[model samples]
Each structure stands twice: as structure tokens, then as C-alpha cells.
Target: MFSDRLGAAAQAIQAQFKHTLGQLDDVPVVRAMRHATHGGKRLRGFLVIESARLHGISSAQSIWAATAVEALHAYSLVHDDLPCMDDDDLRRGKPTVHRKWDEATAVLAGDALQTLAFELVTRSEASPEPAVRAELALRLARASGAEGMVLGQALDIAAETAEAPLSLDDITRLQHGKTGALIEWSATAGAVLAQADAAPLLRYARALGLAFQIADDVLDVTGDSATVGKAVGKDASAGKATFVSLLGLEAARRRAADLVSEACDSLEGYGAEAETLKEAARFVVTRAH
Candidate 1:
């Protein structure tokens, strides 16, 4: 079904990035790049591709957009693994950038990658309009900056010291800041690129982001390294706020399903062009990882 196509696209995009990373001369940089790039469903890139398709945009344009998203995603993961962040030793089943290299090197590498992502978008062949490309870059910046990902990470660090139990709303807000904002942009950036105007797309992406976060929480509770490519139950062990922690597993799972249904319904006007996005909604809730 959609899994096969989605998986193929994800795998292909990762491979392309891996090839690019191989050309770098620095060992630590190479290792960090390789570690960050390995193993994942390139969901953000898929969103860009599918969103573009919905507006009759070609795959050629989507490829470059996908590449930029992938680069930005890798940069985020590398930083997330640093001692200042998640402080992890593994990502996608391999040693994290900080583990593979020194912390300073990992940090610099991530910083470089972040800038490179913007560069990618600026020079992307798929970008038919520089202004639009810049706008998309701004979207990514907003999604990944203090207003979005960084703020969420800060809250995550803050929660580590709080004595009180996390409320459901607390969990939701954290995820909305962390995972949901990025995901919402990832889904809608394509629509933005396609020049497709619709209020429902925004609504769909918002719900889709929440659904994606809930599903991640479910997977963290229920998945394993083999399927997830990262440690399972890490959230619980880290005492991080999650839907499953506040809503209960059953409730979180139900919410995820509901969000997916709503997301899919939002694309009713798109017909077959939105099949990838429709299937993506299902994949979000159903994914093992």
C-alpha cells in the first residue's frame, strides 16, 4: 500500500544525503553526518513532495525541497543528541554525533548543517521563486527556533527539575512547541511552495502535527529499537512530558487516530494528488517507530 511508496521515498532521500555526506573530508564531520543521516522515514520530505504534487508541481521541484528538509532534520537530530540537549549516545541505531565525535565538533557540525540547510533552499533547483524559497526557509527557521523547537527543548530541560506531575495540557503544550510545530510546517510548507491556498490545509497540518506527536508518544511507550531505530520508552525513562504520560496510553492512542481521520478528511478536495498525504496520516498513528 502507501507504506511501500512512502518507505521507498524515505529510503531514497536518505541515501541521497548519505552520498553527499560521504564527500566531506573531516572524519568527525563525516561520522557525525553519517550517523545523523542513517535510518528513518523521511516524513517531512514526503510532505513537501506530496504537497507539491497536490498543486500539479513536478517531482523535480519536490526533490530539492525534500533535500533541504532532510538537511534541516539531520541538523536538529545532531543537536538534540548533544550533552546540552537529549545527551544521547545513539540516533537511528548508530552512535550519536556527540558520541561519534567530540561534543564541540558535534555542535559545530550541527551548526554547519543548519546553515547548510538554508543554503540548500536558497540554491535549490526546485525553488521556482526565490522569494517563496526564502519564505519557506523562514518557516523552517520559525519552526526550529526559540518560538518552536528550541523553546520546547528549553521547557523539556525545565521540566526535568519540576517536582509536580505533568498535566495533560502541559504535555500537549510541550509537544505543540516541540514536535507539533515542526511537523505542521513540514506538511504545509509544500502547500506553501505549491501556492495552494486553503484554510483547511492549515487546519489539517495543525491536527496532523498533534497526531504525529501522539503517535510518537505511543511508539515510545510501545516500540523497540529494532522498529524505532532509537531506544523505546526513552520518554518515560527521561521523565519527559508526553501524551501517554498524561492522557494514558489508550487515550493518547485514540486521540492520534482521531487526528489522523481529521487530517485525511481535510484533503477531500485534493483527490488522488493527496493520496500520499492521506496515507501519511495513517502512517503517523500506525507507525511502529
Candidate 2:
């Protein structure tokens, strides 16, 4: 059931993204945008849709938020892969946008995708209530902007040049902004759309997001580039501190498992209705990529 829901969400977002990108002229920038957003686990989108389902929201209305987050995520990836950034050569098992096209086209495509995210979330189709749409757009900007993901990225960049590796506390704080912020937004967006209280889901997401990053660190140590779909062992090579670096491998694995348990526990209010979410948290730690 979890796989089915995940697959359905991925396909739905892909169609929405294709339809939206189709409106633009067939050019390199547009092609790059399409390529960049083409595929992923679509876990963020799934969280939005599933959380919406838990709140009795319609998939039609929730799909916009799903696609919006995916577009924003794609933008982050494109920029992150640039030579000046992570200098990654591959993503999702395909050539990075900057590698496939020129740097100029990659930049433009990322910029376009970022804007498209807001457009998708703010569109009337996303929610009948203008207030809800406005809230979604506002929060999305906060989650993706300097105060959130970008702040984390900035800190990460600075850490590369720091005299000492980051402490566990520092990395946790950084991940809260860089990765946790968007996950929190996606998980809570459904409650916002339905005018329901989001505190529970917000708690769930905070634990899930950190555990997700810890799992990535674990995979970096244990996975190969082909299996992980990107470069592996980068933190070690760069001498950057990560959960695996701070905590031993066995300890890091235990921490992620504990966090997944915490994440699942946070959904107790929803009972059986949240089984997929529980499964999702488990998957975050256990996934091969």
C-alpha cells in the first residue's frame, strides 16, 4: 500500500510538472528544467498528498502543493550540482543539469523552476480559498529561502573552510534548516489546507527529516555511487563532519532507528490512518537511495 501510494504520487506530480513545463517554448532552458525535475522518489510530494488525505482533503486540491514542492526541490538540486557548488556530475542516475547543458542554461532553468513553484502553489486550482493559497505560498518562500534551506547551504559552505569540523549540535542545527524545514512544510501543508491543527504532523516531520539525513550519511559510507545515484563518500573525502563522522556507524544507525520510532510515534493521534506515514519514516532509514 505504501509503495502504491508513493508510485501514484510520483506519477501524478510528473504529469503536473510536464503539463506546466509544456506551456513554455521548446528551448534548452525549458528542456533542462524538464530534465532536472524528471524523476525522484517524490517523497516530499507523497507527504503532502498523504497528509492531505489524513485531513480529508481532496487530491485535486493537494496535488498543486505536491508539484510545487517538487519543483522547488528540483531547483535546489540543479543549483547544488553546479561547479561552484557541490560540483556533482550525476543526480537520480542521470547527468547533472549543468553537465548535460551549459552552466548558463542550468542557472536559468533553476531560476524558472523556483518561480514555477510559487505559481503552482498560488494558483486558484490549488485551493478555492485565497487565504489558504496565500498561506501556502508564504510558508513555501520561508521554507526554501534564506531562512531555511539556503541558510543551511550557506552554513555548509562555510563549514568546508572552517578550522575544525562541525560539532554534532552544529550539524543538527544546520540540517534543521537545510533539510528539515521543507519536510516540515510538506508534512504540515495538508493540515493548513484543511484548517486543521498541524502540530502533530510538524513533530512527526522534525524527527523524520533528521533521521532522513542521518540515513543519507549512513548510505554515503555504505553505498556506492551507482546504488546511491550520486557521489558517495564525499563527506569523508572533503573531511566534512556528518552524523557518521560524529557518531560511529553503529551509533548513527541506532540514532536513525530511534528517530524513525519517534517519527512514527508522533502519528499516534491518527492511528491506523497514518500507517503509510509510519512506513515512510521506516523507509527513510532503510532505503537504498
Candidate 3:
């Protein structure tokens, strides 16, 4: 059921993307933007939509927020795959933006996508209240900018040339910034939209985000490139410290399961309405990509 819901969400988001991007100019950068966002699990967007659902928000309104998060996520992946960053040639089982297009096109596409995320979140369709839209934009900026994802990326790059591998605590802190920030934003977007308290979703997202990163580390070691849709074992090959490297494979798996439990527990107050989210948490650690 969770898988079905996830698939539906992905389809809806992709449709939104096509409709939105279709209005843009026909250019290489625009094409690259479309390509960069073509496929993925759409987990962050699903979190946005599902969290919004829990708050009784209509899919009509929440789809904008969900699409915004996915656009931003796509932008991040495009940049991450550039030569100066992760330098990968594959994503979502296809050639990455930089590989499919020129580097300049990729850069411009990523920039355009990032800006489009803010535009979508701030659109009148996303929310009737200007304050809510403004709040979403503000939080999105913080999550995707210097204080969040960028900071994490900077730390990751720094770790590459550090005197020694990062300690577990160090890696955790880094991941909290890089991966956890946007996830927290996505998971809490519903409450924000409804002007309700986001504390429970925040707690759930923190655990889920960390677990998501741990799962990614596990996949890097245990998954193949075809299944992962990206380069595998890059961290190990680069001698980069990861959860699997720091805690061994089985230990990392157990830790992910524990975190999934913690995430589900944080949703207890929502009762049966939160089952989909709980299933999503479990799915994170078990997914191949």
C-alpha cells in the first residue's frame, strides 16, 4: 500500500513538473532542467504531500509545495553530479544532467530549478495566505542555502582532505546539515501550511533523515550501480567515512532499523492516520534506490 501511494505521488509530481516546465522557453538549459528532474523516488515530495494530507490539506494546494521540494532536490542532484562535485555520470538510471548536456547547461539548469522551487512555493496556488507562502520560502531558503545543504556539502568536501577520517559524531553533524535540513523542511511543510505546531513532524523527520543517510551508506556498499542508479562504493573507494564504514554493515543496518522505529514512534499521536508515514520510514532503509 505504501509502495502504491509512493508510486502515485511520483506520478502526480511528474505530471506537475511537465505542466510547469512545459511553459518555459525551449532551450538547452530548460531541457536539461527537465531531464534532471525526470525520475527519482520522489520521497521528499511524498513527505510533503503526506504530511499535508495529515493536516487535512488538499492535494490541489499541497502539490505545489511537493513539486517545489522535488525541483529543489533535482537541482541539488544536478549540481552534485557536476565535474567539480560528485562527478557522476548517472542518476535515476540515466545520464546525469552534466553528462547529457554541457556543463554550462547543467549549471544553468540547476540554478533555474533552484529558483523555480522558490517560485512554486511562493505562488498564490500554494497557499491563500501570503504569510504561509512567505514562511515556506524562508524555510526553504535556509534549508537549501548556506545554513543547510550547502554547509553540509562544504563539510563533506573538507572531510575529503582532512588529516583523518571523520568521527561518528562529526559525520552525524555533517549529515544533519546536508541531508537532514531539507527533509525536515519537507516533513514539516504540512503543519506550516496549516499554521499548526510542527514539533512532532520535526522529531520524526530528524530521525527519518538520519536513517535515510545511513541507508544510503549501506546501499553504497551493498547495492550495484544498476540498482542504485548512481555510482556505488564511491565512499569506500575514496576512503570517505560513512555509517557502514564507521559501524560495520550489520551494525549500520540495525541502527537504521532502530531509527525507523524511533521515527514511527514519534508519529504515535497521529494514530492510524500516520500509518503511511510509518511505512515510508520503514521503506527508506529497505529501498534499493
Candidate 4:
């Protein structure tokens, strides 16, 4: 059901953008945009909708929020795939944005997508209040900015060459900044839109965020590229910091389980609506794809 919801929402969003976005040329920029936005699984969007439903929020409003978050996620992938970042050649079984188009075009496409994300949320058919839109924009910016993802990435790069080996704590800090913050924001944004108290969910998101990254580490060590859709074992090969690097695989797995338990506990009062989210936490640790 969770995956179904994600796929259905992604279809709707794709329809919403079909033949839109103005004069899209066949230029490198447009190609980059198409590559980055075309095939995402849109897990972030699903989380938004599901979390909103848990709080009795309108589906339309959730859709607006979800689409906006997904756009930014697409933007991040575009930039992350650049030669300057992950420098990957494939994503979702296709050439990455920068691999299909020139670096400059990829960069511009990412910028446009990021800005478009905010615009969509603010202008949605069932938008949140202006104040809510403002908050969303602020949160997204902070999550993507130097204080968050970018900085975390910088830490990752440096740890690759730093004199000291990365500790488990360092891995947590990096994950919180890189993967965890966006995931948390996606969850919190949904709660915010529902006019629900975000505190519990935010804490839940934090634990889930860390668990997700640790599971990513395990996958990198054990999964194949065909399943992951990206280079596997790149961290170990590159000598980068990872939960696996800091803790042995067995220990990392245990830590991820602990994080999942923490996440589930944070939902003490959310009742059955939170069942999906609880499953998501376990899924994060156990998924093969």
C-alpha cells in the first residue's frame, strides 16, 4: 500500500507537469531536467501524504506539499550527480542528469527545479496558508543549504581525506545533515500542514533518518548495483566514512534496529494511522531496493 500510494502520487504529479514549465527546449538544460525528474520513486512525497492523512489533513494540501518536496529531491539528485559531487553516470537505470547533459546545464536545471519546488507548494490548488508556505520554504532552504545537506556532503568529502578515521558519531552527524534532515522535514511538513503538533513526528523522523542512513550503509556493502540503481560499495572503495566504517556490519545492523525502535516509540499517541510510518522505519532497515 505504501509503495502504491507513492506510485499513484508520482503519476499525478507527472500529469500535473506534462507539457508545462514553458518553452522547454531540447537543449542540454532541458535534457538534464528531464533526466532528473523523470523516474524518481517519490518516497518523500508519499511520506508527506501518509503523514498528513494521519492528522486528518486534506489530500489536496498533502499533494501540494508532496509535489514540492519531490521537486527539491529531484533537484538534489541532479546536483549530487554532477562531476563535482557524486559524479555518478547512472540513476534509476538511466544516465544521470550531468551524464546526459553538460555540467553547466545540469547545474542550471537543478537550480530551476529547486526554485520551482517552492513555487509549486506556494501556488498549489490546495495550498497551505501563506504562513505555512513561508515555513516550508524556510525549512527546505535550511535543509538544502550550507547548514545542512551541502555541509554534510562537504564533511563526507573531507572525511575521505582527513587524517583521523571517522567515528560512529561523525557518521551520525553527517547522515543527520545529508539524508536525515530532508526526510525529517518531509515528515514535519506534513504534520505542519495538518495543523498537528510536529514535535513527536520530528523526533520520530530523526531516528528514522539515522536508521535510513545506516541501512544505506548495509546495502552499499551487501546489495548489488542493479538493485540499488547506483554504484554500490563506493564508500568502502573510496575510504569514506560510513556507519559500516565506524561500526562493523553486525553492530551497524543492530544500531539500525535500535533506531527503528526509537522511531516507533515516538508515536505513542498517533494510534493506527502511524502504522504505515512504523512500517516505514522497519522497511528502511530491511529493504533491498
Supply every candidate's count of residue pairs whose N, Cα or C atoms clash at under 3 angstroms: 0, 0, 0, 0
Per-prediction TM-score to the true structure, in the order listed: 0.92, 0.99, 0.99, 0.93
lDDT of 1 by residue, 93-121 (tens): 77777777788888877887787677767
Cα lDDT of candidate 2 equals 0.95
Q: Name every residue pair that clashes in candidate 2.
A: none
- Return the lDDT, model 4, position 242: 82
Residue 244's lDDT in candidate 2: 96
TM-score of 1: 0.92
* Model 4 CA deviation exceeding 4 Å by range: 19-27, 124-128
How good is model 2 by TM-score?
Answer: 0.99
Higher TM-score: candidate 3 or 4? 3
Q: Give the TM-score (vs. native) of candidate 3.
A: 0.99
Against the reference, the lDDT scores of all candidates come to 0.78, 0.95, 0.95, 0.80
Q: Can you write out model 2's per-residue Cα lDDT over 1-289, one digit (the tens) per residue?
A: 8999999999999999989999999999999999999989999999999999999998998999999999999999999999999999999999999999989999999999999999999999999999999999999999998989999999999999999889999999899888998999999999999989999999999999999999999999999999889999999999999999999999999999999999999999998999999999999999999
Q: Which stretches of candidate 2 lie over 4 Å from their true place?
A: none
Candidate 3 error regions (>4 Å) = none
